[model samples]
Structure formats: structure tokens, C-alpha cells
Target: MKTKNRILQTALELFNEKGINEVTLRGIALNVGMSQGNLNYHFRTKSEIVSELYYNLVEEMDEAMKKITLDQPVFSLLYESSLVSMNILYKYKFIAQDLHSVLESNSELKVHYLALQKMRKQQFLFLFQNMIAEDLMRKEELKNEYERLYERMNILGDNWINSANLFFQERSSKVAHYHSLLFEVIFPYLTQKGKEQYLKSL
Candidate 1:
């Protein structure tokens, strides 16, 4: 692998095992068997590396979402997307916590986070529209219901992401628990046929 890619992979692994704040440039260099200066040559600051990592992760998610067949049932699409997202979080929980911390502390990261939120909102909107078009939703009133639900989900997602710090510290299972709970709350609102299909798939 290229030095840059190697550094990123190593950093991600380390960050996953240890919280972002605990992983230093020297720690990364030590693990990768590179000099601090060499690491610095590739990434000027920790935040820069983090920014790149976040961008790469989002790109991976976007690519994965694109590969899902739109012809699939809406619940299937949602379940697949949720699994992908949860896998990413479970794999890189520390880096995610670090990114959230940096975003909280830095204005530039906040701007990036806001942009990310917009993209996520658009993606959810598209998914919701596809489900509605498929006649999977129970009520026509659900068009507005989903809009409200999307807002709530966004808030909940943010809370869950930020709450990673506390969850990790407490060694709690809140992340997986909350995700399952949220999905259950939304899944029952589907049409009777849709619910049967979803439950059968599960």
C-alpha cells in the first residue's frame, strides 16, 4: 500500500481500539514504524487526518448505498442501510467519537458536519419517497409523517453519535439497543402487507 493509505488504515485501527483523543501522531507512527516527521509529511495535523478519514468513510457509505438495488422493497433498503451504518460505527467507534468531538470543538468541522447532515437528509428523503411510491406506507398522511420522523431520526442519530463517548466510557450496549428500538418504532407504521413482508424477511 502507499504510505498515505497505510497510515490511514493504521490510524483507523488504532482509533477504533482507543478513543481519538488518546491516539497521537507519535502513537500512529510507532504502530506504523514510521518517524513522526514522516507521518507529518503525509498529514500535517491530526485534524487533517481525521477530516480525510471522515470523508473517506462517507464516500464508502455513499458508494454502498448506491449499490443497493432501488427495485428492492423499501423496508429491505432501510434495513440494509441501517446495517451498513451500524457496521461502520461498530468498527470505528473511537474514530467516530473523535470526529464528533472535533466537530464540537472546531468551526470548520462543524460546517462539514452540517453538510453531512444535509446529504443524509436528502438520502432519507429519497428513500422515503421510494417507499411511498411502492405503496408500502399505510396512510397518505404518512408523507408528512415521514418528514416529521426523518427530523426525529436525524436528531436521534446525532444524539447516538455524540453519546458514543459516554457509552464507551460506561461500556454500555446503548448503541445497538437504541438502533433496534428506533427501527421497531418505525417499522410497525408500514402497511399491513408491508409489515408482513418485513417481518418475514427478518
Candidate 2:
């Protein structure tokens, strides 16, 4: 691997092993077997490495989203996407480990994340429209109901990793447990047909 990529990977490993607050650029350089000055050429600060990793995480998630096609049942697509998302998040688990602080300390990343959230909300709205048209979801009957649900989902998505790190003693079950909670957020909005198809797809 190239020096830059190696630094990012090593930084990710260290960040996961030790929380972001504890891991320093010097520590990462040591693990990468490079002098601190050499590492500084690629990333001057720990936050710089973190910012790069955050963008990497977003690119990976965008790739995952691209895998969704119209050929499958919407419910199945959701299930597969949720599972894939969970796996990706787990792979880059440290980003979400100190999510609030990471974003707060970096204005540019916080802005980017907010924009992504807006885009994701539109995507969810589009998906809901499609699901409703296909008899997979009920039309929204309450004011801003789906909107509220999306907010709930956003909260869960943002925090679930940290929550899992704290609550789940075993690493293996963390992704699976949080994944189910995420998918179930939409359950009440599913029509009978949607429920049947969802269960069948599972």
C-alpha cells in the first residue's frame, strides 16, 4: 500500500482500538513505522486523517446506495441495504464512535454531514413514495409522520455505534441488533401487503 493509504488504515485501526481522543498523530506515525515528519506530509493533524476517513466512509456508503435497483421488492431492497450499511458502518466504526465531538471540532465536516443528511432525507422521501405506490407502505395519514420517523432514524443511525459500544459487551451482536432496530422503524408504516412481502423476503 502507498504511504498515504497505509497511514489512513493504521489510523483507523488505532482509532478503533483507542478512542479518537486518545489516539495522536505521533502514535499513528509510530504504528505506520514512519517518522512524524513523514506522516505530517500526508496528514498534519489527527483531525486531517479523520476528515479523510469520513469522506472515505461517505464514498463507500454512496457505493452501497448505488447497488439498490428496482428489480427487487422494496422491502427486500431496504433489508439488504440496511444490512450492507450496518456492515460498512461497523468497518468504519470509529467515525461514529465520537461522532458529535468529531463533527463539532471540525466545521467543514459538520457542514458536509448536514448536507448529506438533507440529501438522505430526500432519498428516504422518494423511497417512501415508491413504496406507497407499490402497496408496500401506507400513505402518510398523519401530519409529518414519516418526517418524524426519519428524524428518529437519523438519531438512531448517528448514535447507534456509540450506543452499541457501550451497551453490547459482545462485538458480534452489535451490528445485528442495531440493524434490526433501524429496519423496524418503518414497520408501523407498512401496509398488510407490505408486511407480508417484507416477512416473505426475510
Candidate 3:
């Protein structure tokens, strides 16, 4: 790996092991076998590193979701996308670990995150609408409920890593399990055909 990428990866590992708030830039430099100055040359502030990772996370998720054809079964496409997303989130696990404090400290990051929230909410709403159109979700008046479900989705997506880290000793569950747990959050909203098809696809 390039020096810059290695720095980011090492920083991510440290942040995951020691925690985002607990780790220092100097510590990252030491772990990566470089002076603090050299590290600063690449990332002036730890926030810059985090911001880059955040943007990368957003870009990767968008790219993955784009691969899922909307014409396919909504549950199957979403399940695959959710798995991809959760894996990306796991890769940059430190971001979600300190997302709140990081956002609170950096106004720019906060603004970006808020904008991301809006975009994701709209995206989920659009997907839900697609499911309804495709007869995958119950066709009913759920304007307010859809908004609530979006909030739920956001909450789970942003915090699952933190929850897993705090409670689980094994990291294997990330690739094997928790992302499916996220699906459970929305599976109930599916129509009978949707639910059956989703189970079959799994």
C-alpha cells in the first residue's frame, strides 16, 4: 500500500482498538513508523483523515447501491446492498465509533453528515416507493410511517458497529450476522409476497 493509504489504515486500526476519542495523531504516527510532522504532511488534522474516510464511505455506498438494479426484487437488492454497506462501514469502523463527537467538534463535518442524512432519507423513501410500485410492499398510506422508518434505518446504520464492538468479542459477526439484523428492522413492512420472496432469496 502507499504511505498515505497505510497511514489511513493504521489509523483506522488504532481508532478501532483504542477508540476514536482515545487515540491521538502522534500515536497513529508512531504506529505507522513516521514522525508526527510526516503524518501532518499527509493529514493536517485527525479530522481531515476522518473527513476523507467519511467521503470515501459515502462514495463506496453510492457505488454499491448503483449496482443493485431497481427492477429486481426490492428485498433482494436491498439485502445485498445492505451487506455491502455494512462491510464498508466495518472497514471504517472508527467513524461510526465516534461519529457524534467528531461531528460535534467539526461544524463542516456536521453539515456534511446532516446533508448525508437528508440524502439517505430521500433514498430510502424512493426505494420504499419502488417497492410499493412493484407490489413488494403493502400499498397503504404510510407517509408518516415511512419517515419514521427512515429514521430507524439511519439510527441502526450509523450505530451498529458501536453496538457490536461494545457487546461482542468476535468480529466475525460483522461479515456473517449483524447486517442481516438490520434487514429485520424493515422486513416487517413488506407485503406477504415480499416477505416470502425475501426469505426465499436469503
Task: Estimate, for each residue in 99-202, the C-alpha lDDT of model 1 and write its tens digit.
Answer: 55868867776897788888878887777676667766665464478768778886665456556555555433665665665566677567777778778655
Off by over 4 Å in 3: 69-71, 140-143
Q: For model 2, how does the per-residue alpha-carbon lDDT over 1-202 read when each residue is reduced to its tens digit?
A: 9999999999999988898999998899999998999999998888899999999999999898897785877778888988888889888898888888999999999999999899999999888888899888998899988888889998998789988988998867998899889998888899999889888877
Q: Each prediction's Cα lDDT score?
A: 0.73, 0.89, 0.83
True-structure RMSD, every candidate: 3.6, 1.4, 2.0
- Residue 33, model 2, lDDT: 98
Q: Give the C-alpha lDDT of model 2.
A: 0.89
TM-score of 1: 0.78
How would you encode candidate 3's per-residue C-alpha lDDT over 2-24 as one tens digit per residue? 99999988887887678877878
The candidates, ranked best first by lDDT, are 2, 3, 1
- Please report how far candidate 2 places residue 2 from its true position, in Å: 0.7
> What TM-score do all the candidates reach, one by one?
0.78, 0.94, 0.89
Ten residues in sequence with the least summed lDDT for candidate 1:
164-173
Residue 102, model 3: Cα distance from true site in angstroms: 1.2
| Segments of candidate 1 deviating more than 4 angstroms | 129-135, 140-145, 158-179
Write down the TM-score for model 3. 0.89
